[model samples]
Target: MKMSDKKEILNSDKAPEPVGLYPHARRVGNLLFLSGVGPRKRGSKEIPGVTLDHLGNIAAYDIEAQCHSVFENVRHVLEASGSSWDKLVDVTVFLTNMQDDFKTYNEVYARYFKDNQPCRTTVEVNALPTPIAIELKCIAVVDG
Candidate 1:
């Protein structure tokens, strides 16, 4: 088989537009690598649960809302790339404020990953590209 057949870039119209120049996920062999995905709504710049100040700073945010939306965004990318929520093998979560958000995020996460629990790592970061509070990087298995 040609080398090209082993690697494919996958983009989902239903997912939020990537903040950088990257596909939503890249398929390599039987695995899919998802770029860091935020909770921005598709076809718009609005970030769920984020209320910005006049100068574009995070005034207040809801971790629950962002968590739910980001999960949905990941699901869209996974399904579009020939995978499913149950196939997710690993996930990396980045939060702007761990002390303030981790509990809420984890609670929301448990509801979503209750059945297909994937290996997960959550860390606090200085900030993400946008005003959103959370972002997720994920990996999944893609079966032929």
Candidate 2:
């Protein structure tokens, strides 16, 4: 395939830097694929609403705060990729404690997604790469 056919990596200065080598998002044709985004903000390691114990373990976390931050992060990525929240087609959410956090997460999710309802699948996971309790993987369409 030609080099032009390869995916274009996208990043957002308004969003948090990824913990790994990957860019915040990638564009393949008219579709924008976003990497997993957590609650951490740009230029900071502190997870929003997360309280750590003396041993650096997660002592407490606010799912609501994480949800809002993660959603805004997704928006930044989408916009940086030449897309928007209404352009999102699908989203996959990862939660470390589904049973305890789902309700609050869903409520916060409703506030942002009420108008632009995208296909979503939420699942419980043992852990994330970081101490964050929630993360979002999203895909959206870019206009030609």
RMSD of every prediction? 1.4, 1.7
Best by lDDT: 1
lDDT of each: 0.94, 0.92
| Candidate 2, superposed: residue stretches over 4 Å from native | 1-6
Clashing pairs in 2: none
lDDT for each residue of candidate 2 in 45-140, tens digit (9 for 90 to 100): 888989999998999999999999899889888888899999999999999999999999999999899999999999999999989999999989
Q: Give, for candidate 2, the lowest lDDT window spanning 10 residues.
A: 1-10
TM match of model 2 to true structure:
0.95
- Write candidate 1's Cα lDDT for 1-144 as tens digits: 754369999999999998789999999889899999999999998989989899988898899999999999999999999999999999999999999999999899999999999999999999899898999999999998
Looking at model 1, report the run of 10 residues with the lowest lDDT sum: 1-10
Q: Which residue runs does candidate 1 get wrong by more than 4 Å?
A: 2-5
